[model samples]
Target: MSETTQRILPPTEALICFNLYAASHGFIRLYAPYLERIGLTYPQFLVLLTLRGPEGEGQPQGVGELGALLGMESNTLSPLLKRMQGAGLLTRTRSEEDERRVVIALTEAGRARAEAAAEVPGCIAKDTGLSEEDYHTTLEVLRKLRGQIAGLDGKPATE
Candidate 1:
């Protein structure tokens, strides 16, 4: 793909969406080897990254919070969280005040893994064959478009 705009774009919305979906996954695949060394699949890495965010109070985060922040449905999040927990990457517990709520926290092991994996962000950008500045600029524009498409009724996609 050249940096120039395509004279003939995709004819339909489905074509455009499918291309982006495939491209995004391909982009992640470029980082697959690096992420694997840290013991994270893309989704698992995303879950840890979400909970590592600075919540207002700096307290441990809950699964629902991660689910919303990550733009994941509860049903979808359950198995992912369970798998990560089983792998010792996270811990899920019910809040004493609210039994219905399941809080998720990084295990010491998880924290180290997250930190180790953090290096991949820059490395992956470098591997993309795009300069850091151009990469970030493109990411911002795409993020805005994704937000509009996803709609405010649901949470925005994970950063």
Candidate 2:
């Protein structure tokens, strides 16, 4: 093929997506034991974390709101919420003012579980061996990249 027509693809090791995918798996593996101890899957743990406020208080929220915050669709989040409710980790109640809305709140058990898992982040951070500064910087960069990528979903590929 002519030089202009030749398509050269970078090796997998040199691809950003490949590195991100591998790092995500590694992070999940690091979280596995801690999550298991808290009787949670990673997604379940994320739910608890999102439901918690900065001050460590559980914030009661509508199911739709919770799903949005977690970047989950209702169809996917519903079954997980149901399972959590069954496990006594949370309560799902019809909103008093809006029957169509289901509100989610952490039960005492769920709060306790969240507290128990509080150290998991620290553990995972330490395991990564990244300095505190580097860790925060990396997290910031990843979040920015994720947002930018997500924004491109409906846009033309060339853009």
Candidate 3:
């Protein structure tokens, strides 16, 4: 067979992107039941988690702020925020200081839900079946990789 026509096994193991993508899907599946019990999808849960501040406070943020934090666009986030608002999980209000800016805040119910969902990280860590050392090591590597990629676009890592 010509080199161009030769068929070889796919190098799935060699592709970091593929591994990361697949792992994310796996984690989503694992998290589905937990999220469903609380009437949330993965992304919705992420939004609630992000809105929560230190000591369970709800930090009011703007749509732009949330989009920037989640790496999402307004077109996508607006509908999601609306859905959450409809569900009484959060509220979006026009800023008093800036009429053009909209601020988002979690409701009391949202705070309780977020607190309830805090156990998810522990569940995920347990599901990974990795030792504490390996888990931290892998997390650090991924964080560094994300930082490097962000830096390529002239944006520093958030931390």
Candidate 4:
């Protein structure tokens, strides 16, 4: 082989992307049992959490708006929303102001489910073994990294 052809790539363990991928999988595994008990998939759990909001009060949101918040395309979010609605977790209705807009609101059942899942983050945090400060720092770093990566190729990071 030529000298150029003999160049070696970084080992998988040394690659930040690989580490991040593995860490993500680890986190998912940690969340699996809790999510299963709640009868929600990871994506669905994310939707539920987002709709629950930080203040524990969720206002109705437009389909497009919800999709944007979740970083999901409407095509992907629509079927998930439909399934959630079928399970009586939420309601989808056309906006009176704009018939073209479909609004989503958590039903009573959804609120109850959200309440039941309240301890999930705490459980995951305990499993992570990160101190409060370290946890916040890690979150800040990850968010910054994600924003920078997303901003590549002239794409908006905040999206």
| Winner of 3 and 4 under TM-score | 4
For model 1 the local lDDT of residue 96 reads: 100
lDDT of 3: 0.87
Compared with the true structure, all predictions reach lDDT values of: 0.79, 0.88, 0.87, 0.88
Model 1 accuracy (lDDT, Cα):
0.79
Quote the positional error of residue 32 for candidate 4 in Å. 0.5
lDDT of 2 at 44: 93
Q: How many clashes show up in model 1?
A: 0
Residue ranges of candidate 4 with Cα displaced over 4 Å: 1-10, 153-159
Give the number of the best model, judged by TM-score: 2
Evaluated at residue 40, the lDDT of candidate 3 is 89
Candidate 4 TM-score over all chains jointly = 0.87
Which residue ranges in model 2 land beyond 4 Å of their true spot? 1-10, 156-159
- Per residue, candidate 2 scores C-alpha lDDT tens digits across 1-159 of 444433464467567889999999989999999999888999999998888766787889999999888889999999999999999999999999999999999999999888877768988888889999998899899999978878888585596
Q: Return the lDDT, model 2, position 77.
A: 97
Q: Which stretches of candidate 1 lie over 4 Å from their true place?
A: 1-15, 54-59, 152-159
Clashing pairs in 3: none
Candidates ranked, most accurate by lDDT first: 2, 4, 3, 1
Question: For residues 1-159, what per-residue lDDT tens digits would candidate 3 score against the true structure?
Answer: 344433452567456888899988998999998888888899898899899865666789999999998889999999999999999999999999999999999999988888877778788889878899999999999989887897778654575
Q: Candidate 3: worst 10 consecutive residues by lDDT?
A: 1-10
